[model samples]
Target: MNVSLTSEPLRPVVQTRPVPPALIEALSQRFGKQLSLAQVVREQHGRDESSFSVPPPDAVVFAESAQDVSDAVKLAAQYKVPVIPFGAGSSVEGHLLAVQGGISIDVGRMNQVLAIHAEDLTVTVQPGVTRKALNEAVKSTGLFFPIDPGADASIGGMCATRASGTNAVRYGTMRENVLALDVVTASGELIHTGTRAKKSSAGYDLTRLMVGSEGTLGILTEITLKLYPLPEAVMAATCSFASLAEAVNATIQIIQMGVPIARCELLDAVTVRMVNTHSKLSLPESALLLMEFHGSPAGVQEQVETVQAIAAEFGGDTFEWAHTPEERTRLWTARHNAYFAGVQSRPGCKVISTDACVPISRLADALLDSVLETQASGIPYFMVGHVGDGNFHMGYLIDPNSPEERATAEQLNHQLVRRALALGGTCTGEHGVGLHKKGFLLEETGVGAVAMMRAIKTALDPDNILNPGKIFEL
Candidate 1:
C-alpha cells in the first residue's frame, strides 16, 4: 500500500513550532489509546488529493464523538497548538496539510446519521458522514441529498469547502442545501448556528459563514441538511459535438432557455479517451456533453426533445440515452472517476487541477481560450466541467519530478484563473481556497474584502490555532 504522491516545488518548507513536552504529555494522558504519535498514522492523515506535498502532522487523534472533538480542541487550545480537522481526506485543495505542524483530529470514526425528519425534508448527521452514506441512509424516505463534489467527501468537509458537483445545476451546492451546524468554535465552545426551519431572517447568517470557511473558523461537529424528493422520472443521455465550442454553446443555450437539467457535464476528446480506457466502455472520442433531466415522464420527454434539438443545431451526433438505473450509474461513475482517469492516463504524473467558474454567457470565451492555451503548451491534460452552472476543472497532468512541467501547469492555471476573474467569475468555484489558492483569493476579493476576512479570522480564532496556514494567511 505504499504509493508515491506527486509533489510540486511548492512543497511548503516545514518550519514547525515545538510541540511542548508538557502539552504532549497532557494529550497522551487525556486520550490514552485514542491519541497516536505514530508516524504512519500521521502520514495517513497529512496529505490529500492535492499535488502539493508537505510533512505530516506531529500527532493524530482519533475522535469518535462530539465530546471527543470538543475535548481535543480544548486540550489543543490550552497549549496554543495548531489543530487541523481531518475528515475523509478527499479534498483536493491541500486542505489537510499540517503546514505549521501540530495534531490532526480525525473524525472519520464518528460516522452516524443522527436524525431523519423525512416529513420536514431534513436530515442531521455527524461530521464524518459521507455523501454516499447520507444518500443511502435517506433512500427509503424517497429523498436524496444531491451535492456530490465527485469524491465521497465527508459532509463536514463538503460544507467547509461549500462543495457542488454534477447535481448542483438543479439542487444547488452545500451553501444552499446546508440548513444548520453544531460547530466547535476556536475557544472550544460548542455552539449552534442556524435552524432546521427552511428559511430564516436569523442574525448574522453564521451557518453560511462557517460553511465555506475551509476549517479556518471552527470544527463542524454536526450538520443539518436540506433534502429533496426523488424525481418521479430521471433520464440521462450523452451527445458528441464536432468541437468543444459547439458543446459549450449547446450548454449555454440549455441554461439560458431555463431548462431544468439536473446534470450537464462537458468532456473534451482527450478526456473521453481517458474515461473510455478507465471505464472499459466505448464512448465517443469527441467533445461530449453528458446530460440528465429530472421531472415527470412527460416533462422529462419534453426536456430531452428540446436538448436534442439544440445539440443537433450544434453538430451533435450519436446521442445515446441510458434507459436503466444501472446504465445511468455506469455513466456517472465514469464521470466521477475523471480525476483518477487523468492521473492514470499519464504514468507517475500528478494532477494540478484548476477550479474556474465564469458567467454562463462567458463560459465559451473562458473555456475555449484556456483550451487553446493548454493545447499549445502540449502538457498532458483533461478537461471536464459541470457546465450547467459554468463551473469546470482543467486537470494538468505533470511530471512531479520535473519542476518545469509543474511551473508550466501553474502558469496555465494562473492564466485560466485570471480569465475567470475577468469574466466576473471566481478563482475557485467549489474547491475552497486552501493553502493552494489563497493568493488568488486576495487577487479576486481585493485588499478590503480579504482584510475583513482576516479580521473575522482574528476575531473568531485569535489564538490562530484552528487549521492554521489555510485559506488566507495572517
Candidate 2:
C-alpha cells in the first residue's frame, strides 16, 4: 500500500555547493548504512505545500533522536553548512526554504511520544510527532492537544510557527500550550527551556522566544505540551447569510456576548462556491459560519442559545446541526480542504494562502475592505477564517510563471497586512514571519523590536548558518 503524496513534485535541480565525498563518507561511517547524500535530494528536499521562495537544501540527514540533531548541527557548524530543520514540511510560508543551501535536517524519523503524564495533563514528544498522531495517542486518556493549524503539522513546526487553529478560540495557540522544549542551539549545544510545572516566573522566557522563531534560533528536538480533557458534550452548527458582512457581524456579536465558542469560522461566498464545485457539496452561494460548542450539555446549550440570538440580530439564517461524528467530520473536512478547493477553481494556478489577524471588533470591516480591494484588482481569491479569533486567510490564485499576476497578488497581500496592522492586529497570526511576511514584520513590530530580535539572532547564531536569509535579513 504505497500512498504517493501528490504534493511532492519533481523540481528542477537548483545550484548549490555539492557535499564533498569525504564528508559523505564520514556521515556514512557515523550512521552505518543509514546516511546517503543521493537519497536526501530525492526524498527530503522541497515543501509539501504552496510555492514561495528559493530551492531545497544541498543534502538531508534523517535525525533519529536529540543526539542525532545535536551531532548533525555540530557537523554543519564545523563545515559552515546551513541547517534547516524539516518536520512535516507543511509550512505555507517558506520557513524551510534553503536559501543558503546546505543540509536539511529531516526530523520526521524522530517521531515518538516519550512520555504521557495523564495526571499532570502534559505530554512529552519528539519533534517529528504530528498533531493528529499525538491526539489519537491520548484520546483514550480523555485528553487532547488542540492547537490544530489545519494540516497535520508536526509538533516542532507548529511550535516554530506558533500555530493556532479552529480550537484556538478555546484552547489557545502553541504559545500557551507548549510547556518546554529541548533544542539544539546554533553552537550545537543541547538546551532545555521552560518547565512542566504549569507555571513559571523564570527570567527571560526563552520558551516563547523559540515558539515563533520559525527554526531560525535553534532546531527543536523535544516538546512538552499541555493537554485538555475531551469535552463531555459537543455540538456543531452551520449558519448561512446572504452577505459575508452579516455573518462576520454575527460572529463579532457572538464574541462580544462571551458565548464561549470552541470554534467559529467564516466562509465567504467565493469560498462556499469553490467548496461546492470542488468537494461536490450542495452548499448555497452565500456566506456561511460554522460554530462549535463544547462543555456541559446545559452550558453548551445556553451558549448556543445566546449565539443564536446574536445571529438573528445580524440576519443569520436557520442553523443546521451535525448530530453524528461522521457528519461532523465531513463538515470540518470541507473547511480543511479550503486551500485545495480554492486552488482547483483556477487551473494551472497554485494557491498563495496568506493569513492576517485583526481585532475581533474590526474583523468584519478589515475582511470586507480586503474583499472589495481584491475585487477592484480583479484578482480571484477565496476567504476563510477563524472568525472568533479574528484570524483569516486569503487564498489567492496566481500562475506560477506570470510575473504580472504574482505582482498583483503580492500587492493585495501587502495591503491586507497593512490593514491588519493598522487595526491593531498581527500581519501573521499562525504562520510565522518566514520569507513572505518579513516586510510586514518590520512594519508591525517596528525597527527597535526587530533590531533587538536580530541582535538575539546574532548572539545565538553568529555564523548565520541556521536557516540563513529567513525572517530578518541581517
Please, what are the lDDT tens digits per residue for candidate 1 over residues 317-390? 96899999999999999999999999989999988889999999999989999999999999999999999999
- Write down the lDDT of every candidate, Cα atoms only: 0.91, 0.84
Q: Which candidate ranks first by TM-score, i.e. highest? A: 1
RMSD of each: 4.5, 6.1
TM-score of 2: 0.94
lDDT (Cα, tens digit) per residue for candidate 2, span 267-351: 9888999998887777667999988999999999999899988999888889999999888888888888888898889988866
* Predicted structure 1: lDDT: 0.91
**What are the clashing pairs of model 2?**
none
User: The CA-based lDDT of model 2 is what?
Assistant: 0.84
C-alpha TM-score for every candidate = 0.97, 0.94
